[model samples]
Target: MGAPDYFVILAEMRTGSNFLEESLDAAPGLKCWGEAFNPHFVGAAGRREMAGIDIAARNADPLRLLAAIRERTDGVAGFRLFHDHDPRILEHCLADPRCAKVILRRNPLDSFVSLQIARRTGQWRLGAKGTARMAKIRFEPADFAAYLDMQAAAAAAVTRRLQISGQSAFHIDYDALGDVEILNGLCRFLGARGPITAASSRTRVQNPAPVSQKVENPEEMAAALAELSAQEPFGAGRSRSLEPDRGARVPTYLVAASCPLLFVPLPGGPRARIRGWMEALSPGGAPPLQGMTQKSLRRWRRTNPGHRSFAVLRHPAARAHAVFVERILYPGPHCDMDLRESLRSHHGVPLPEGPPEPNFGLDAHRAAFLAFLAVLRGSLQGQTGLRVPPEWATQSALLQGTAQVLLPDRLLREDMLAQELDAMARPFGRQASVPPARTGAEATLSRIHDPALEEAVRSAYQRDYMMFGFEDWRPEAAG
Candidate 1:
């Protein structure tokens, strides 16, 4: 009944975080709020009042608000923190001895699948809802790999923070959630007294069966899962150390540039075929930036001075649509759950009333897409927190900083990829035939045919329109 000590539930998506937190909250003299620092969570009026602050103050000075919540709580006070939460709050929480840390983990494969199911069904937690929605997700190796790598990175980051602060944390696993002993152990870790029993988890496991039952590519996923489980020293797979640098732009097959062709890669652009043509120019060699270093990057820059450098650009509306369908609407690891959360939390998009149909209604998808664009617009205007998926980020923003320093000589339109490739080739007296540009077959610009959504897209990517000479985009519905 005094000033309460604090504790955080460090977790990732679909890691039984809700279950763990609910169980912990049920204990006497302990309370763990859900992702208090999450943009969406913070903006909720109910959550704000619970924290004893208004939404504006919470956003303006979250650290103070976080501290206030801890001070105001009746007993042990804490909140859930994801890898993508506000950094300032996470830093303060780790640095404060009054704040205990509980790190939660789950089988990466299971977690990834659960996340996809929840996203597809819009049923994040349990209810009297008669049955769980079953979704058949076509598992792609790349998507799985990316998901594993991302989750691993988030865990490693928290470990690094703990190490820097010389702090130790109580670790819990998703598999241990239902056990009364495990629940009690968590309570004890939070300085609770007396015997505590596990509470019924507020959520249900969406998929309780083998991975093969839900996923199309179960064999590959199983092999990858085995490899991941066998990993020792943890968080070791592909070396993504370079991911922060140049936005994952390691030169592909386009290393040998006859004309100082500095091909700045754009995610979700025509990078694949462009690189393929570069590979055609020369095969059976290590691609550019394959083993690149900071020094090597500088060397390439120095080596390519006075050469023709270019990047391909896609219409912002088209790129956003493609990213939404291919990444967001799909059931896979690459789905941008964080972005979706931000849209709901910060942008005021209403939560869906029911589980999403496997093939979502076109109007529903369009509204969601509009919400995403709204968040992106905020990010473009220097809003922070939610890490915008690079694939859907405005080209103008992605090309800033080091990429900006490399100054592109030309920006090729995606629709004219073939024409642009031939032009670059003609300058060198070599004809390079390239494949046609790729678009989202499942969804297109027409998805957001509403005038309002189209306006949002235009506002979000205004810079792209002005810089790339894309005619002002109006929704087909408007016309």
Candidate 2:
């Protein structure tokens, strides 16, 4: 059989990628693999799972994967493109020039916001062994500024990778392309003509509590949840009501600092089999990295006492806020882990049994971020029994000042992005992490119904912006 002309679709998750990939699948001769290295013995058999399916063995090597890809897609037509978001997928991308490239990017603010949500919600990419790989491989910008700066940094990384390759490719903006236009554009980019339809992007994951539908088959949903829960990475915690924060309370350490912004104490998949592979490829040869087991991670923190070498956590308020906003932006199927479950698991406090709820949108996020500071500040000022560790103040100040101060308002407004610039700015937010002082934004808000107060809401953005090195305002403040 003759080798078919193939195109590779590259981007991180939830960037309208599924819609793009499925468009190729719509063409009669065209076929798309969500994760090309994923089983079905479609490619070379470097490794075999218990089910006897071939999978990519290492993250460092791409020729084997490319060879497998060439071996695949023979005699296939219309369009034979492989879609994936993992950074390791780079090897395969660079390997074959015959395969056209299609790169997708979203607004920096939206993407970072989505990632934060994904962390809390446990929603992950199905492309690269799921979320664990996706998190590590994410090319999004997160340069030391608040969430916004980090987002810009992530965007920039994608741009750099695309430019370095310098291949003829299609670049997509998630906000710009509509369903019909995107699919159609992808067809033209790959030089394949086909009928594009909305059904191509139809997802199997359904909403159980969609507003109008009185669920006729509750049992099916329950069964599915049970099945998913059994395999869940964090496992399931107790169920509770999603009622407004009347009864909800987040943890002190999480809100106050002592953890990185993107922390998940819960383990992902199994322990690392060969961390040495990454070290070999990495500049410093990062030690034989060990993927920790959940039991061990939890136990080690307990025994090590002062030493928390695993599951370093931080940015509860920001992360939780991101989760809330993701719902409004991308209303897909329910995420893997429920929020109440997290409250129970992290704090060892269970909730009363009840139906689970979805994360609210951007407004919820804004409120949460503010409340988190308010709560933490109260503890720090010795209002609550909980004492705010001094480090808490430093981290919060860094986050607030960087995101609000250093960066431009455009980054946070919605859909504004400079991928490369954003990627370069991420390290700033984490630089010199000290407990920062948290002033109560709530007290001021509580007193004023004035529109100027709304303007004040926008003012805090300067603190965060400064960390990212945004705008003309202040390099002096960053130090």
lDDT of 1 by residue, 1-479 (tens): 22327888888878878777767777888877677888666623246544577666777888777778768767778888887878888888878867788998886766777788778888776532235677867666678789878987888887887898788888977766655576786787787654455344345455554456677766666666666566532221211110111343444314444444557777866666677676554445324334455467668778766556677777777667767666665545866666555556756654353345766666677777777776566444323334445685667656763363456678777666776767876765556567544534323565556667667777777656666677644332111
Instruction: Give the CA lDDT, 0 to 100, for residue 41 in model 1.
Output: 62
TM-scores of all candidate predictions against the true structure: 0.45, 0.32
lDDT of 2 by residue, 175-219 (tens): 333335555666666655455653232321111111112223334
Which RMSD values do the candidates have, in order?
20.3, 24.6
**What number of backbone clashes does candidate 1 have, counting pairs of residues 3 or more apart or in separate chains?**
1
Count of clashing residue pairs in every prediction: 1, 58
The lDDT values for all models are 0.64, 0.35
Off by over 4 Å in 1: 1-4, 43-49, 128-130, 223-479
Where is the poorest 10-residue window by lDDT in model 2? 240-249
Candidate 2 residue 438 C-alpha distance from true site, Å = 58
